[model samples]
Target: MKNVEIGALILRVVLGVTFFIHGLVKFQGGIENTVGWFASIGLPGGLAYAVAIVELVGGLALIIGLGSRVISALLAVLMLGATLKVKLAMGFLGNGQGAGYELDVALLAMAVFIIINGSKLLAVDQRFGKRQKSVAESV
Candidate 1:
């Protein structure tokens, strides 16, 4: 496939950083607060931690291109949950619950785009992927 170098890079970096910031917000309220918040919303405490780690670590992974597709896919699902759990009641219109999930939807779409496109040139994923493919083909 022909490489779209700029588009691939843009999707990875932008979505990665944005997802990372969402995780960073968790640190602001502390784990105790996060757990409490989750419990308040009827989610398990452990699940809350998992969500936090996934957003933080997954975003970092995407940034380094270590597991871009996996990370992107999971984050897309996470955003899906964010919408359903919290934003659904708010509807598409802006509300006190928070701004509508237009931004979250955008991020989900961007991550999905990265998944289908692969990490592309200049990505560590591409480098390792090539090596693995050669081994598989030889075998």
Candidate 2:
């Protein structure tokens, strides 16, 4: 694979693992607490479940390079929401109250990159794309 393809793969795995672990934590550590925290932050408590599901499923999709662009786009939106709604006030570096938006921004950047370039190396999307192309050509 080319260097860019390798880079894309690395980014996909890292972002996937990060989001998966976070989503898992929300479920494992008690989603109710996460819901409460969301409400406390002026967001609807029910939104927490949607967020968790997206993180979990999206992360897995990214890791497997399935629908990479779409999943990355979703993750990018999630990170943007997190930064704007929750972490912006705390600043980039954060304060005593909580962590900052630096990590969120980084993740967002990665997601955007993937959205633009896609997961080129060892991607299920590539397999499907190639098969579809050949089938169409044969027809």
TM-score of each: 0.86, 0.95
Candidate of highest TM-score: 2
Task: Give per-residue CA lDDT, model 2, range 1-139, as digits (tens).
Answer: 5899999999999999999999999999999999999999999999999999999988998898899899889999999999999999999999989999999999999999999988778878889999999999999
lDDT for each candidate structure: 0.83, 0.93
Model 1 TM: 0.86
List of clashing residue pairs for candidate 1 = none
Global fold similarity of model 2 (TM-score): 0.95
Task: Name the lDDT value of residue 15 in candidate 2.
Answer: 96
Candidate 2 residue-wise lDDT at 56: 93
User: Which residue segments of model 1 deviate by more than 4 Å?
Assistant: 1-3, 133-139
Expressed as tens digits, the lDDT of each residue in 76-137 for candidate 1 is: 89989988988777777658657887887888889889889877656787788889999999
